[model samples]
Target: MTLFRQIYSLLFGLFLVVVMSLAYVQFTETQSFLSKQMESDLNNTSNSLGIMLVPDLEAGDIVGAETLINVIFEGGYYQQVKLTWLVDGKQQVWENDLKIDGVPQWFIDLGFFKTIKRESTITSGWIQLANLEITAHPGFGYHELWRSLTNAIIMISILFLIAIMLARFGLTWILKPLHDIAEHATDIAHRKFGPDMALPKTSELKSVVSAFNSMSHQLKQIFSSLDEEVSELRKKNLVDQVSALPNRQYMMGRLNSWLGEPNNGSLMMAKFDWLEDVHGKYGYQVRDETIRLLSEKMKEQLDEIAPSVIARIAAYEFAFLITSGEQEVCSKYLHTLIRTVNQEISKAGCKPNEQFYIGIAQRTDDMNVSQILAQTDNALQKAIADDKVFHWFESNEKQLYTREQWREHLSSAIKNKNFQFKWQPVYLTERDEIIQRELYCKLEIAGKEIHAGQFMPYVELLSLGSLLDRCLIETIADSGLLDRNHEPVAINLTFHSLSDKKFHEWLNHFLRNHRWAKRIVFDIPEAGVYSDPESCEALCHIIRDNGAHFGIDHFGRQFGSMAYLQTLRPSYVKLDQSFAFYDESEHSSELCRALVNVARGLDIQIIVTGIQEQPQLARFEPLKTNAYMGFIYPPEPVE
Candidate 1:
């Protein structure tokens, strides 16, 4: 039982014992007094009646004696009254008998009072005429005793109930401060800090409340300081101080994460071959202004593309990662980007054609980091040699599907349920084991497997993300992968599906029916959460309410506040792939440590991706992150 119940029960028991004891004491005392009073009354009546009867006897009026006895019996105070004459072999007798009334048989049967008789001698001078006898009935005594006992009990019982109610309210009021303290601790455990509690009048409780408030304040300060330090370190290492774009180290780390994904992006490098000549002629100020102007102009032109990055790889060279995989969109972006670069250079009083050239490289599954850079450099040579603003590398690759063909391919895939599952396992650093497996789904068209990024752009363009998500869900549900014996899998939910109420309804019903659904963890990208945090948070609650789990994928990828973790506390958060680009550098270590501290404070597991080297594990293990996923255990077909 709880403390409240235990204390209440004890109080109730004490009240009962006191009320019962009071009633018993009152009843017994009243019974004793009635017994003594009856005896006294009997003695007094005998003395008085004997004197009156003596006169009648002496005067030879036996009839008067009989009349007196009859009168006494009719009064009903006595159950039996007797009269006798002490003459020579003659006697006058009077007798009466009556039953008790107005009392229960059980009360009378307790035999608390018995019959009491008194006899007195009557004579003219000193002789006794006869014995005047009087007996008292217990009926009236029982009735009086019963009435008084029950009345006392009734009054006491009412008092007892009222006392109990008062006691309960008082106890609850006294313990309320403790309840507040408990709730405060629970909130802190969940990373929720509430305002300080009111100081209780009770000294013991006041001390406890004060301690909790102190701890909460100190924790907040500690976390704030750590966050600021990490933020500063990131700015120093990842940010280019000149143009304020990402530096080469930051881009390399970012590329590591981007390449780990199954999708490809267009990597464009902007260079100012005339920078050295201009710097020597116009001095350092003009050169710095030119670099700064280039970045500002690029941001204005590429404002439409999101989830992308711009980085300065060298003093005069900058790189852009265009996330679009569509050939037409990539070409359009490249053309607009070249125009912006030429405009910025011309505005800085430098001719664009004098020494400015751009190199474009498209990522492929067959290419690695070194090959991409080599190909981009070759493309830059071609641009300068041909006197062009930019040159895109030729790969002699053919498009798999046209715009109209994509619709048919996707419809057929959804209808046929041709989605295949692959599991990419993440390493749990603490346990030195694989605890989380991310499910990567791909569509199969004519025996060719296609990655998500290759098709998701089209999926969003066609507005069929919801349909595809539903189809993929059903396929996974029917697959044997949900068996209790298998490890739990994490599946990503599309932004469209999260926003769609119909999909939410279907998911609710599906989870209700499928018991094994608890083994699945729903995932949403950080960008999706940024788009609509409230809706995404509600969806997460839905998933968790149904016994399944949810997490944020690509966490810390955006430059938004991390405070949303308090409201949308997920089972886990996979750090953006870029953070995994650990190079044993001080800034890298600071970033990892800061993220881990924040995640641990919230009690949320943090996973880092894109660890490519065995030595990288050594660099990150000391930070004590929950898990890591990278090229070491890339996604593979689920058998």
Candidate 2:
């Protein structure tokens, strides 16, 4: 049980015990007090009556004695009042036959009074009068007692309820501070080692916070010192101890960051393949001198583009991040720079023909620095593969044209609210009818619709893919289609959106309040799943946890990484159009069979793409594919 519940239970238990004890004491006190009062009244009444009857007993007037008893019984003040007379020293009892105090026999059987019978000698002329037997009926007294007890009980019950409520309120108030301290501690526990620590107000909590702060601060200092030591180690490992530029350890970061960004600039990468060759042919001193000379010549040549940053990313590799006005301008500058370096090396009288491979990718904001650099590296690999001196920067025109301008356009499109959802029908093959419709983002700019491929990169760059996904979720819920009993809708998400833990958390909460619990399907890409395998698997887990299904689009296109498919285990894999083309070749058939077997092992349903003929359907059906798209559904044209 929770602490709050435990506290409430303890408090309530104590309250119950106190209430029961008080109730029992009140009941006993009322019964005892009423019994005593009834007994005292009965003794006084009987004694007084015995004295009055004495005179009548001595006169031996039976009528007088009877009259006296009748008068007293008619008064009805005493409970069961009776009188007795004595004649010739022999006792005779006289009482009215009429019932005096009317008390029910059943009520009397309630055992209200245990009366003491007492007698006194009544003397008139030295004669003993009759003895009087008086019994007390506590019925009336008990009735009044029960009524007062009932009132007390009601009052006590009200007070008990009030006390319980007050106890709950007070306990809650007292524990509030403790709860705050616990929550603060939990949040701090989740923080990374170097996070800021703040003290709480409670004494014990403040002490704990202080200790955490001290530990965190000490850890930060230790890590800072350790980082400096590693930096020095990196220098020793990757760079010549004398040159302060960069060690080989810095190369990967440099290469990856460069590859991530795309812009309108040129990259010149030089590989020193001939250095070792020359060093092997010559003495150590001669080779060292040659290396120094070459470094100096390259530095001088780079000084022309001094506005750019030049760093030796590795032992044998140098990179320049130079800005040129345009593609042609950068291309000309690169050619000139290479020519100048060659000329300078020849004049120095060193080895005249040293080979180097260089490649460039024209900078575009469509990609990150790392992706751009990878493109340049890819070009260099192609140059080396073909044994060319250098390959010039080139743009993938068709792909770049769609992505480049649209990223900027999307920024404006978001601000102006130009993005909208377009629904496309999904068919259930067995029913031969529309099972549901999928929502696709359509971005409009000046009367043109830009597809997700065109604008999605910008969504990623701005970290708004989840925001866009949330907007789509809200739109679909508000659309009223989910109110239908069997309606389902598929929503596409980016890798960023799926991988974001915060976004997925919010999405889960949103789905709970939504009525479309069983009908929502999420569509993601196969390439994205392979990009970060662990996060992809976690994303799939969370989606399934929320009781929704997932589908893989563009599957089998980026062919080599099927490990994620088995690990993430998506509900269905939609084969890419490129893989579905008609081919009678063994290679194509082998690829198809391999995909089927792999998916079947994982129990993942498969969907074929671009099925334009009965022959295509025949091949997929034999493999037991669950669905097919393309002309079978007739791929829709972009609007």
Question: Which candidate should be chosen as best, given lDDT against the real structure?
Answer: 1
Best model number under TM-score: 1
Flag regions of model 2 displaced more than 4 Å.
1-30, 56-77, 84-133, 147-311, 315-359, 363-391, 394-512, 515-639
Give the whole-model CA lDDT for all candidates, comma-separated.
0.78, 0.61
The estimated TM-scores of all candidates read 0.84, 0.44
Error of model 1, residue 469, in angstroms: 3.5
Q: Write the per-residue lDDT of candidate 1 for residues 380-484, one digit (tens) a residue.
A: 889988988889899877666787899989888898998877888888876767776888778877778788767776787677888988888788878767873
Question: Which 10-residue span in candidate 2 carries the lowest summed lDDT?
Answer: 254-263
| Candidate 2 structure quality by residue, lDDT tens digits, 229-306 | 434443444344323444333343333333322223556676656555555667566656765666566557655643
